[model samples]
Target: MRILTIIAATLGLWIAATGVSHAEATYAPQKVVYHINGTGGENGAGYKPALNNISNHISAVGADNLDLRVVMHGDGLGLLQAAIDDQQLQGIIAGLKNDGVQFLVCKNTLTGRNIDPETDLFDVWPEDIVPSGVAELGKLQAEGFAYIKP
Candidate 1:
């Protein structure tokens, strides 16, 4: 029927117009938490990829629009270890922090590994260290922070 055809056409046009309007609008604030549990060593195999993922994440959601946090636990503490002597990594981590990306280390991991946070982790404060990394992540998720494992 002509009426049915006209109705479909009108609906389609309305949807198209609404889509265009939405495309022109800015996005709301996005929050994300990245969990790192893998250890990447001198070969820079796994760690490099995790770093790239973090970089891509920041790029995807304009850094300014994101409340990004990297939760390091288990073997992932190697990232902090890798940065210990590397000034370049320390600088990059500091820059990321300055841009609002937080780096959280697990206190349990430190105690289990017999590692001292004061010397091993650069720029990490006592308050930033959580009692349980995974539990903290779950808490963050409950608080509406998106979860990511990279």
Candidate 2:
């Protein structure tokens, strides 16, 4: 009976090991787009929480295996406002960018607000400015990128 118990335990261990290995073998890269249209004072503050989720995702899948982009338009353009108003907020954005996060601003919002994307936005370049935020979201999804709002 003791020998039989030992065999059963060995088999259980083998099964558990294989199950873990199978799960790890299924790892796949992820592409995600985060949509933010809330103003900085309230809605913009939500970026921190969204960023936390992104960090957790990268932790689970590894940074090199993750493609993440943030689209900011409408009142959401206020996200950059905190960074503009405070140097600390600017550092926060810089840190995230270092982690391969992409921040895309909307040209339509900039034009409507008479804000210059090149000069007014921090670390924002011409390429970072999409023609329209909503349209960009659609394009990203069509390109096989999953969408999230925070």
Candidate 3:
């Protein structure tokens, strides 16, 4: 647990150092979409390390240079609810949002689960809801965004 925290902190530091860095963004155009459909009662903790990987990515490349998206569907809907269940995760999602990380949720998931997008989902906008998460992934991939499961 301690090691994971340390690593997460390090990743956050790296992300902070970049600060929407344009140089890194212009140097290498990295467009990645993180696909998450966690099983086993999915939530933010299910892939907290994955968040670190994204931050590390920005650190390695640059936020301005990277077109990063975290598309969550199926059980992954738990990510938006994670902070609601565990208050500790409150700012985690907010931080990613601040760094311009696009958090997309499936409309199907929302409808199937009967979750109200505006109220149930934390800080989710209408634009963030996609018709189908899987289809969105395909569209994004076709657009040249690298798909990352982790």
Taking the tens digit of each residue's C-alpha lDDT, what string does model 1 give over 30-103? 88899998878683356767777877766666677789999999988888788878777777677778778888
lDDT (Cα, tens digit) per residue for candidate 3, span 21-129: 5456346778899988885254566667777887787767766677899999998877787766666565777877787899999999999989997777678889999
Candidate that beats the other on TM-score, 2 or 3, i.e. the better one: 3
lDDT of model 3, residue 110:
94
Error of 3 at 4 (Å): 38
lDDT (Cα atoms) of all candidates against the true structure: 0.80, 0.79, 0.81
Worst 10 residues of 1 by lDDT: 19-28
**Clash numbers, per candidate:** 0, 1, 1
Error of 1 at 40 (Å): 0.9
The clash number for model 3 is 1
- Stretches of model 2 off by over 4 angstroms after superposition: 1-26, 42-44
Which ranking of candidates, highest TM-score first? 3, 1, 2
**Of candidates 3 and 1, the better by lDDT:** 3
lDDT of 1 at 23: 22
